[model samples]
Target: MLSTSEMTPETIEQEKLYLDLGLSEAEYVRVKQILQRRPNFTETGIFSVMWSEHCSYKTSKPLLKKFPSTAPHVLQGPGEGAGVVDIGDGMAVVFKIESHNHPSAVEPYQGAATGVGGIIRDVFSIGARPVALMNSLRFGNPGTGNVNHLFQEVVRGIAGYGNCVGIPTVGGEVQFDNSYEDNPLVNAMCVGLIRHEDMQKGIASGVGNTVMYAGAPTGRDGIHGATFASGDLTDDSDKDRPSVQVGDPFMEKLLIEACLEAIQSDALVGMQDMGAAGLTSSASEMASKAGTGMIMNLDLVPKREANMSAYELMLSESQERMLLVVEKGREQEIMDIFAKYGLEAAAVGEVTENTSFRLLQHGTTVADIPVDALAEEAPVYHMPSKEAAYVKAFQQMDERIPEVNDHADMLKQLLQQPTIASKEYVYDQYDSMVQTNTVVTPGSDAAVIRIKGTDKALAITTDCNSRYLHLDPETGGKTVVAEAARNIVCSGAQPLGLTDGLNYGNPTNPEVFWQMEKSVEGMSAAAKMLETPVISGNVSLYNQSNGKSIYPTPVVGMVGLASLEDITPSFFQETDDLVYVIGEAKPEFGGSELQKVVSGKYEGKAPGIDLQVEADRQQQLLRGIQAGLIQSAHDLSEGGLAIALAESVFTGKGLGVEVDLAGDATVALFSETQSRFLVTVRPEHKEDFETTVDNAVHIGLVTNNDTLLVRVNGTTKIEEDVSTLHQLWKGAIPCMLNRKA
Candidate 1:
């Protein structure tokens, strides 16, 4: 272990553990020159860490300016704790996604729990009542003990916090592979509801305004968190576990109520949560956004432990904490409300007119930095682009045919695969019914929630299958976009806009660069076809561990517009409707589940894309549903048509059907044909539904008897009771979990 005396600048610099601060060679020299006039501790490691890329967005800040965050319907956007959009009728929706990659790699459970905790606070910080929560998690294969432990712990962590906080974990996606073994990516998103006029901004103004700290007391935990996030994890990260903050959902629960109540009383001017960078970031940003300054007295801060240093108080990422800017006279009211909840509230600072951030301890100045230079300015880089080599390689591949024996068993095994199985166990722990706005819950193509007053509702879904993208980026990317849009269409919604979280390996490598280029091009092409533009997004690089990188994962978070009248839930109704397969299923078995199960390999190419046809199909499906011609709809995705049919039956009241296919066995069962939807229509409207789409095919009808049968070329190829099929489908997940040992 290194001693305090030996923890000098040279040693720390050698570790490459300091924030870049977005400083140029000359600007850095200038900062050093200015620091020479300050005390020793003023130029210490904590200060530098707080000013780094993870905290300051030194690299991404410039590029984020190009996003269209604000629209006529947007109540609030960038610079706030979370973005708020006007959902109409005096109501607004607050939503945002944040990354917790480095910390999760260091300590999976606590890291993931705190990530959920932090994002919830972000939504509630702006006076919004958090209603829904979601996460997009990527990890290594679960067959390994360590990876399995991480996966289980991370899932439990999300459940523990979100469930306790009474916020429902509505929807999310999980991907497993070798690349994320050591460097897992855990991105959490939160959505909340608030009145449009009551939304709060985290800004500090007025020379006499009082600055207060509420919730938990400051501690040494999570020191230099921003710097820790920016650096690559190594074998020594086990020693840094203490740097990961601990979460307390009980305290967060109380804080949420207190903050929301305080905002309503007009006693608060600005508010922000002390996440990642803690007090330093919250206070500096609040003041900077208001074009003002602040002077924080470290000695006056409420601390959990005695004798805390000024730097520790500023940089600590202790959970359940928030900073507030209150008018001078209303400080007592704000303090009383927090005190009643048995929470600590202290006036540790005061807003200043001078445009500089000042820190004070024991009535003596510790550090002073210009607010404009430190808060608003961070470096942003437009990275160089390159052509992906895999694109051409996949385009040159020849399709190979796979021999099928007992296609029924093949379908059962594919549905049982961990990736394609039901995630009910995970979502059951979430409070998805909290706000009473959810129209359709988990285990669906997309989640639909009412917009409260209007006849309009919103449909949200997150999708991506990186394995396909890994095999063929362009097609994989296009499929993801197409599938997400199809999911919305299945719910009777028109695709609106998209937000992507691009997870990739080191971009400096040519192979990784190619993946990025192809994925983006594919996404762009699909987005144009769907008529949805990329709005807000995040890019996460360096997602590799143990010398291996994860597949190019560009998880798409899509939002669509839907009318309340035409909303179609994922589950089918009673047994009298006709079930139809709406698109052609071709015998293109590249990169398919049949290949994985039969061959134990992943070398085949992914499905191809026909943009025009997909777009037309989407529009036709929406028209059909809106006209009340289609009763229910579900998109065909993972595990192909067989799995889609299985899930549809499982969700319905009962399964009753016999599928008669006009195609080959493999093509009829396992082919993941895009733009295809399984729909249920009343026998009377069957003709209208058939004519709604140009290429619709009626394959079967719902039945009262609990049996599923498949007929291929006039032969009964597969038959099973509904209960047995359900057992097989549900058992797949637990079986895979038990196999981990």
Candidate 2:
């Protein structure tokens, strides 16, 4: 690893080749002309990076402007650090999902861990108490040793930070594929709770406002994160690992408490977390948004090392730091508060009268660029687009209908696929008990938490199965969206909004681009059907390595509204309740679990979508549960009806189920059908629930005996005690360890 001191002028020039730098002849002439009006290189780079499409909303900004972020229930949205939704009674919830794809691809563990740490700050920087943390991780298949190392390290990194910070890692999505072997995507989502009045913004106003640097001291780590993220990964990306910051969760925990306390004291006017673009980007953005100017003496910034260059000090993506525009006289008070936590704090600069960003290093001016020119005028380009040609893989008819001599043993084997098995091993590493606000934790379909002091609760979940998407982008995307919404609805919540992290391979490839286009269309259609607008999302492209790309993975993070009185957790409480399927299940075996279990081939087109059916079923189920007509609900996914039934039984108070599928044995058991839900309704309300839901089918009744008996076409396929079922489901993924090469 190269030290920061070794980064000479020649090294800086060498690094420039990896980024576009946006310094075209025409752009340079335009910038110079603007500089003729006023000149500053540091300010120019800050503005350029912040307003760049990667930082600024130049391209997507105009489009995102159309979203309904500020509804009647919205306490804050868009321009703020994170979106805040009013949860009634002066309480609100803040949530946002961000991508750190480029960095994580270079250095998986630290890159991912720091990504989590950064987003957590984004929440608490706004005076909110981060309640939960979730990550959507996409990587290349772990069949290869190196890929396995990256996967294990990334998981450990997320676990390490989340656990250390005392925030529960409630839920998330993980997928493996070839495209991501080299360039993985690590997108983290954080949700915070705060009082409506406590919410803060990233604006620096009032000429006398003092700008303070709080948290860890400046370092050379992640010097050009924004530019790094905006570039494509190549075989030489290992050399770019220095651009990924090393995380310090201990420092971050202290920072979170100190910042929240500082905001509570009414000493700070505005605040912003030092993420991606770090100091230069955060300060310039705060000033630009406030329509004011800022004058910074970089020399005053507390540093971990001596003799730092102006650029190094300005753009360093140092972890766990924040920029705060304090009310002049209260700077010392805030500094004292941070100091009590053993964290560093210093007054770096002041808000200025002129609308330009100014920097003085060692009392000498280095750069002074116009705020708007640098912050809002970065270039935006529309890339070339093309359609992907569909080519079906070679199919073997004989392997499709494998002889299952022992149906019970085959079901056990199928349950053991890593994708369908319990994620206890991973969830166990997380601190799911942190804030005492977690209403529903990891094992449930969706995690629910109370909105502090309010009668309302919020349900959240992230969902995606990339293997299905790689086989069929359109259907796979739609199914995942529906599944996420279904999970939330199963908890008796009305779906509110969505945040998507679209992870894909190199866009330069026509085939990958085609997958992306199709996936987006699928997601758009699903969102429309569900009436859930995507409020915030991220696009992660070029998730490829060594000339191979992973499957198209568009991870959907959804939030929904539920009153405390109506919350229905996924666990079944009564043994005698009737189990029902909310919608009809068809024999959609295109990309079914049956295909993976019967034949080792994992390629095939996913199931088709019936948007109307899905929407109607979801709506009916939500109404029934909210009306207290049902107690338990779970969505069908991964291993389909059989797995769904098994999971419901495994979590029930006592599981004895007798179900008869009115279809073919294999098709009725393991088909990857959509728009289906397994719900347990009271014996008396079972009839009413069926009537309420348009096409709900009463499959069986839960019994006192802890055994699961599934009869298909008069054949008893699975007969296992609840204890055995639980053991099998929980041990499924662990069993895959035996198959690991």
Candidate 3:
């Protein structure tokens, strides 16, 4: 209810400035005590935005610390713009995923566009050339008119920015559900390549260094954007339109080249992207990290609008802007680089020896506050938590997984469901091959991008099932990481590092907070045992609308590494190739797609993770690929055995698969078992494959005919044409989204 208009010119009270700036009373008192006086208008604005939940991670920091952030291959972890891992041969990969939820719900196009722009900046700011981009999108049913419009616009926004910037939108995931009806999530992930020595930190080191600003000019747009992201979307969300920053991909393109070139020139000390809290976060955090201070002049900054005040310039989230700390006497060299790209690089500030950040407007001091106090001293709250009653009931439910009466019809129904159906209609619009490094495109188990010169390659995948999390948060969290790792490892790569996008409902709700705590604990335990340290990630809370919260969705975006010779395709390659099942199938049906399709419910217990078994399977698969034994590999997830088999044959024409299964019908076909894989080997290498891969079973072989058949214990259970099932699987999503057959 406290509005900025309440603070009038003549009647303004210095003590109440934080209230108008959206800070809690306790936080205001803390600010006052830190400065030993009531904060001035400019100082209040800076602290308010920097200390907000979105920029400071006040509530989530303690939970984030539980994740495994440091591994042997990790060069830099959580504190940087994006995590960096040494990927061998003196090259490293930089990547991260962040959310732009509330803004996207209000203004889909600009919100989504800026999200892409901001992440790209994060990558290049660390002195890396962004190679690939991916997004994890969730919405209400796109079949409806209103939601369909939003879905289309968000896709277009992503394409417009990524395509124009020339970063290939390689691979991502999308699902339509009612939980996202009013508050859709648009999470963006970007991966970049850089030499190990060229990797830079976003720190402002050295006293008396020259500080500069470049790219787009400051404007009235996107004022208070960071604070807006810290809160929930309400009925008045549309009125916050001015808080969303507009993006210009062309300008961003120039900035990328200029920054990369300048970094190579070795004239810059540190660089930070002007995202989130805009100038406030980028400047204060950099100086604080470097154990330095700064004095900035608002008048020297390039501004697109006239008569902009100090508060507006300090907090505006203008797109395509960056702050650079350059070495002394090389200012012109840095300026000339950006100027060559037609971007203005103006001297805006200088690093100081004092430990305070001082602001100047027209040679007059406006705000002075301690650098570390503003960036590192936010109030971190340990939220109150209580487990929701519904969670226990859902987990303890006695619902039965229906019998496999008609396996063929059941496969078709599961294929048509929104979650299991093909997403070609959505991926078709993205430019996945622009950079010419995409080895395996969107339809595969995980995306593989070639490292142009070296024999090395990279793999990426994202996975999460909200229903499983809703029923059992801890298990669902562990399963998501396991699933993502399985996809990457199945594609014949060794798990290297991970980046997570944690999406949940309002954190203030005790039930929601409890879910968050449990999920993080689960994810942490799994990461440590697997040794896939979580290098970089993001947390997005307050994902509810109209008093309705979404199911817990903690999306894991993982990256893996391998030599080009180790990459494996996820498809049926040749006739007479021996088919084998790796890892055992259990009677686990909790949170399975079969339950959703047949019983119309999300019930049962989630499958528990056995770290030793999971680790053995990953090593076994990696060894097989290294030994050139695996002809093709794909993990069994979601629809379990049946769905994975169908997908393997979905892309091939005139190719059929025949498999013999002897087990419980439901468990063998659709049990949603974890850490299992379907693999094929050359007939000649069958002996070595079985000898090398433990717990492996020879199932059947690829057939040359058009008919796909499955027999359980010598009895035919599923018999259908490959083309018939392919049509239903591939056309489901297109039909729904385009409203056309």
Off by over 4 Å in 2: 1-48, 51-53, 57-70, 391-410, 452-454, 471-475, 508-518, 599-605, 652-654, 721-725, 735-740
Name the better of 2 and 3 by TM-score.
3
Model 3 residue runs over 4 Å out of place are 1-20, 739-741
Q: Best by lDDT, which number?
A: 3
* Per-candidate TM-score against the hidden true structure: 0.90, 0.90, 0.96
Query: Candidate 1 lDDT (Cα, whole model)?
Result: 0.76
Decoy 1 TM-score against native = 0.90
lDDT of 2 by residue, 77-195 (tens): 55667777766677877888888888877787898899899889888877899989887777664556676677777888899999998888887766554556677778899988888
Local distance difference test, each candidate: 0.76, 0.77, 0.87
lDDT over C-alpha atoms for residue 455 of model 1: 88
Q: What lDDT tens digits, residue by residue, belong to model 1 across residues 1-741?
A: 554445454654454323342233444444555555322344444345545656665444444453445446656655677777665568766776777777788888888899999988888988898877878888776666787778778888888888888777878877665667788888887877788777888899788899999999988888777766765577787877867988999899999988888888777898999987799889888888899999888888889888887767877889999999999988899999898888878898899999788898888877787766566754344455565566567557777657778877777777676677677656776677777788878778888888776788777788888878888887888988888899999999887666667777766566776677778778878877777655545666666655577788888777776889999976667678888887888766666767777777665578777989999989998999999988889988766778777777885466667778866877887787677888888899988887787788888878778888888999887787777888877776555666746
Q: Candidate 1, clashing residue pairs?
A: 58-379, 388-514
Question: Of the candidates shown, which would achieve the greatest TM-score relative to the real structure?
Answer: 3
Residues 1-741, candidate 3: write the lDDT tens digits: 433434442223544656656688788778879999777667778888988878888888888998989978999899889999999889999999989887888889999999999999999999999999988998986687768777888888888889999999888888777888888899999999999888889999989899999999999889888888878789888989999999999999999999999998778999999998799999999999999999999999999999888888999998999999999889999999999999999999999999799999878888899999988777899999999888877777664656768888898998888778988877888899998999999878899999999898999988888878888899888888888888899889988888999999888899999999999998888888778899888888888978999889999888999889889999988889999998788888777888877777777777767877888888888899899999999999879889988888876668889999988777888888788899999999999998888989999899888778999989898999989998898898767777621
